[model samples]
Target: MSIYTIIDADTHVTETPDLWTSRAPAHMRDSVPRVITDSRGTHRWVLAGGRNLASAGMTATAGRGTFKNPPKTYEEMHPGAYDAKARLKYMDQMGIWAMVMYPNVGGFGAQQFLKLNDPELMLTCVQIYNDWQTEWASADSRRLIPITSIPFWDVAAAVTEVRRCAAIGHKGILFTGEPQYYGLPLLGDKHWSPLWEAAVELDLPISFHIGSGDMAEGLVKERVATYGKMAAFTELAVDIFLRNGLQLNDLLMSGVLARFPKIKFVSVESGIGWIPFVLEAMDYQFKGNSVAEEHPEFDRLPSEYFARNVYACYWFEQTAPRRLIDKIGVDNILFETDFPHPTSLYGDEVHARIKGGLSDCEESVRRKILWGNAQKLYKVTGPSADDEAKL
Candidate 1:
């Protein structure tokens, strides 16, 4: 293992085709999620009621190397993408001490399941994913940290599931930045306070993955047809970053952070390059509006609250770490390797990128971004006493 105890704040788990079918209730088994080969020879996931969710391309391209053009089949993927034991081995090879795992088929925050006509079946699918995650993390609890997803359609059910998942060992919860996409209330509405409160009470950090909200699928298609696959991928990345910025603006301007001071918000897979600009603009806007008269709940400027509660992660970022680390506060920065994704840093590249990004920084800041921030945010422990003794 490498010298540093790196904790990847964002990673993914490709769900097995039987994930939903095997655990689903007997009455719902016929309609749960399953994989099917299309006439074009591409594997796709079809949810309950026969709705096509996503192709196998994005979910199973981990070990395909530079050949990420058409996306590979599940059989072509490395076992590490789905198997717990194999994943740990991959982590060992990469020197990643731990990772907060998110879902692929679940739409980063399980948002895809909301399309189901039956809310009960949607909730059941979510529970099965959570339970399966718990089992996966059990392979090496200290190394494979699972982040759970809840039923966003019902506020009460979300709260209940949040508590239940935390009790069962989930370190964090993946939440959609735009709940209105599912016809639910916005993040700032009083409707979300109960879920936020439960997250705080359980000490579970709320993670918002890019593209987990109201994603524009048509934009991706247009970009690919006109500009090619690489350009299409770039468009998707840019869209996720822009939307995540809007979500951050909403959280800050909406007084959510002000009301829930103890809770933490993690911007997963969203780079930190734009954080300084956003905070600077927020401060200017807050002052320009004469803060108290407009948003009295905000006791201080938006940047101040962000410095204290919000965290933004970076993987391939080179300039942000050098220029904005001090501005964002070292404690509010985390590191990640998107891992099996098309944009991921594979093998030793993760370490090299992290090292190069933090080259001009101090050891303390490097330590925090590499692993310290995650350890505190997730309450992660170990290289356990036994492991340490052996080391």
Candidate 2:
């Protein structure tokens, strides 16, 4: 039986080689995503146009030592990364009651689909991934919450998929922080209004994960090349942190939150420390700048909307909980493990790390950060009363 009622807000699932191929229709099978070995013997996923997506090594890193030496093949990775049954065993050992799982090769928000010129293929890929995710989560539906992705290039299609996935028990939708990179409308653009409305009406939170958009690719590559593997990893982490902050600012300033009051936005894998500063800066800018004056659509300060609708997750952060908890608000802060990623809080250490981070807070605040907030945000009722008591 587990001791902690924990919910991981930003874990990942390394898709198996056949995740898309097996589910694709006969006519589309040839064009669906499949694995191919490069000349160097590295396993990389190849998309429709023979565009090579990232390798599995980049996604499956749990139990492996150091970012400098990630697993180079599917055979070297922990089974929990792609196998739900194996994941539940690991979850039991870690005492995590539930986890919100994102994609790996699918580019977090499945943004890689945008690279496909065939819109029909792209939409089919999205459906296949979501169907596979649903099947994986079925291994233990109460504990594994699958987040679905959509074709952001088409807002109407996105809305349809959002509704479809929600009807099948998906808790949230994973989307790119910046859709403008794909020549699609930005989050604040009117084209996204229907999607946002569908999400709001469906009671599904729209989650924005760092690196899900195109903004970080160049910087990540540059950092990795300039610095060695470990240093490059550190630089990427910092870069993602800053990018999430910018995304938050964009959504806030865009007046989307103000417009859709009930819709929630989660900044996944983005720590909580910077949130206070962003909120403060947003309020300051709203008061001091003419942007707010020119756009009177904002009913209140950006911070107000953030406090009400925005959420941030922290996996390995300690200082944020200690120093900025009150400013960030316990309700606005959640917890994550980033499981199976290079920098995850995996194995027995996860409990110790999370407990140590929350040691300074009141028990109530700790409970909220650990599971209470997630329960409310994701609408997780947990296992049945009998099942929970047994655990």
Candidate 3:
């Protein structure tokens, strides 16, 4: 009889070594990324930044996982890694009633398959990854909301993929935010329209999660070129805002929101503070006739459309009760624990931290931040009267 109502809006699970290989059709199964020992005597996936895939505690390999390697044991890297029972037990212990789980490896990693430039191959790879992820979430549907990943290279194919994913019971879609992938900028491209339409038609939210897919290449390239550890992560986080702020503004100003009123967009891992600043700057610029003149598609104020459609994750550093509620509105902001990310704060301290920041607000507002807001965003319904009464 658990009474806590916390909903972790974002969390992830590493793909098992057999993820694509096991679920993929015979012809494509062998194409999934394979793990091999590197020059450092560590195991790493051929595709990932080469952080050892086996060292993160997510793998059982003797070498262990690294950012350069996958975990040696899925359980160790992911904590609850592959076991549903362990995951549920941890959720119970931590007072987390539900979570929206994204894939660890197969997510934007599916983009790697796209880079192969074979549509048939990309589609097959995506299907297998989705199948495996769906099975993983079936372990506990009540607690885990699985977000589907789609390959965005071909618009028609992407539309077909979205419908298939929705049919398979996905709550949302995960996409990469990078502009140039293998030497191509996705900005202002018409190829993404159909998939955007499908998401709008299906009334599903599209979540742009951070990682290789959507991360800015400029910073990553700088880090790789310079070999400066401190500068790498710092530049990376800043680059997220610079890149995504434009993308979000583009979606709003391009009449994507107006054309598809049902589509909702969430920018995860990008933090919430940027929302206010971006919206304000856009609105200010719109008044100058520059944004409107350059992009004639926009008719209404850009900020209004954004407020109606966009949502961002709240980080500990960005949690300012009054200013946040005032600038972004309580309903538009949601909280997340970067769970298992080393910096994640997911225990009783969460209650204290949230309480401290939100103490000035009424209990209703606090409860909204704690539970109701996420339900509204995720469209999760509480138990029926009979179900609640049983408790």
Q: What's the TM-score of every candidate structure?
A: 0.94, 0.94, 0.83
For model 3, residues 185-237, the per-residue Cα lDDT tens digits are 36346666777778877878888776545543544566767866545756665
Candidate 1's displacement at residue 218, Å, is: 5.0
Weakest 10 consecutive residues, lDDT, candidate 3?
54-63
Candidate order (TM-score): 1, 2, 3
Clashes of each: 0, 0, 34
Candidate 1 lDDT, 293-313, residue by residue in tens: 876777898999998889988
Model 3 lDDT vs. the true structure?
A: 0.65
Best by lDDT: 2
RMSD in angstroms between candidate 3 and the native structure over all alpha carbons: 4.3
Residue 331 displacement in candidate 3 (angstroms):
1.6
lDDT winner, 1 or 2: 2
lDDT of 2 at 9: 87
Model 3: lDDT of residue 190? 60
lDDT of each: 0.83, 0.84, 0.65
